[model samples]
Target: MKITSAVVSVVLLVSAQNSFGQFPAEEVSRFAIKDFTFESGQAFPTAVVAYATRGRLNAAKSNAVLLPSPYAADLHGYDAFIGPGRALDPQRHFLILTGMFANGQSSSPSNTPAPHGGPDFPRVTIRDNVRAAHELVTQQLGITKMTAVVGYSMGAQQAYQWAVSYPDMVESIAVICGNAKQYPFGVIRLEGSIAALKADSAWNNGRYTQPPVKGLRAFAIHYAAWSQSPVSWPRDMLDSMSNQQVDQFLRSLEAPALGMDANNVLSQAETWKRHNIGDSPGYNGDVEAALRAIKARVLLMPCRSDLYFPVADAEYEATFLQNGELAVIESSAGHAAGGGADSQAIRFIDGKLKGMLQ
Candidate 1:
């Protein structure tokens, strides 16, 4: 159950390497929409959505599997489950990996031009991301239907959104460590992280001349405490740390956050805070009704130790689904369990996904 520092380092290293396009991709492309409209009614000219694909579309174009990026991740977010013999074997299924709107790879506060850049960037919703990905699949890839939509964390939120928003388009969806709605407690956690990032003087109300190192560090510290289980801190960190080494360990945790753009972080956090399947058309904010409307088979995999998306929430949500299964990840890795951070958890997930896809 304990994830040692070495394991943490390897995970970070792999993520850093993947960010540079090291992961396998048959092709990497960007789909641009002219005058893209947000769910909030704000419009941005030439919003670009970045995506990557592996494998070839069969004659019917029916073997497509969509993998949406989680918060702060890119197209390669599902690299661990995609390979020759993996659950989502690229050779067997055409894998369409998408970047989240605010992850910098896609249209984001960091990459967008003025007027709609930085603090002025319009709020993005999980439904908005689904709409964009829908366009990419239908218009660009000519995919009429997807065999599955598999996701973890924020990506899982998108997966649930896809099932409800375009039920007929997705045959199945696997939601890992995410819920159909952003519960009040989850909103508070995200708000706290956002507040910490914006509190630094150098943040300058999102017009920072330089990176807000202090603010980012504070945000990272806050996130680190919640991202993993309380038991993990003692097993993986406190037990291994001496008084003299405490500061070094804390700095290591801050490194990743420091490299991220402040505005980009805020943009995704806002999107996460606003996610709700019921927000889709005709639901009237009725979460249970939305879940009942979904036609796709659902696999709900919530980590037992996940503080952000509790297992109890997933179990309750599963009851509403017309066709859903609840499978808890029994690991102390918390949310990371669903992100392929634990080898055993990854195997369990892959097996479940294989069954779902079958």
Candidate 2:
């Protein structure tokens, strides 16, 4: 399919299912980390990281680009930008799309066995996810340096961590609708969603025999309220939907959340909450110091109306980077704007990313 067509499909899927479509088997793969140690000092005997790749690694291995998945997404999260003639053209750059932990495909609370499964799973930070991806790139893929790290939402958080955690490894980074830290407002928003999920009697503190459908539905509603701009509700949804249609639309959002494992959802949310580049080793908890230490060319793309990661935060962050360019996405699609929610936003983001990659 053409790049534009693929992106349109991605937008539809994201709206309806909160996920991207599947890729061919040949493009998928997995890497295992032996005795992996997390930032929380918890160790797992064998931690598996699932990933998907496209294109060929050049002889010098200098053309590789890392695309980390966002919260609750798999490696296909960046499908909108992965086709030919797109910003991440596979023919030109070797794309490594890695899935985040607790995302079902990778090591997570729902998929693991007893002792470290469910609520007993150790706390994992954004740094831990980045560390595992670093291992996958260096040890598994045999790539020393990556040309760029492109990410959206939680993926963007990982991208920022990559530049800070290993300054010499990544040459450039595109942080789309994401922040270096999970600020106070974001923490409160996420906590509310978590609380809604736990309120279902079926949740049973994450030990339920069956999925907590009621709790998941409540969580989905809570997230939907904040995921889009208030303007979008009246302009895009209310104007287009009848009263019955609005109810159907809401049920669509709940469907995806209901299918997900509660513990898995909570796992990624916890990871998102603890994201702070300032907390990286040697930074002394100084956010500005960590941003200033980045050696990569940084591209900050925060949507103008994104509630999750506001443009104002990006503006402040750009001031600290050694070599950073703040390019605000002019859209009311909120956080989804950076994830190809609309054709115009997709085009705008693609243009910025292409320039940054070049």
TM-score of each: 0.94, 0.93
Q: What total of clashing residue pairs does each candidate reach?
A: 0, 0
lDDT of 1: 0.85
Q: Which stretches of candidate 2 lie over 4 Å from their true place?
A: 1-26, 235-244
Clashing pairs in 1: none
Q: Candidate 2's residue-wise lDDT over 227-271, tens digit each?
A: 667765543434655778767666765666766889988989989
The CA lDDT at 8 in model 2 is 37
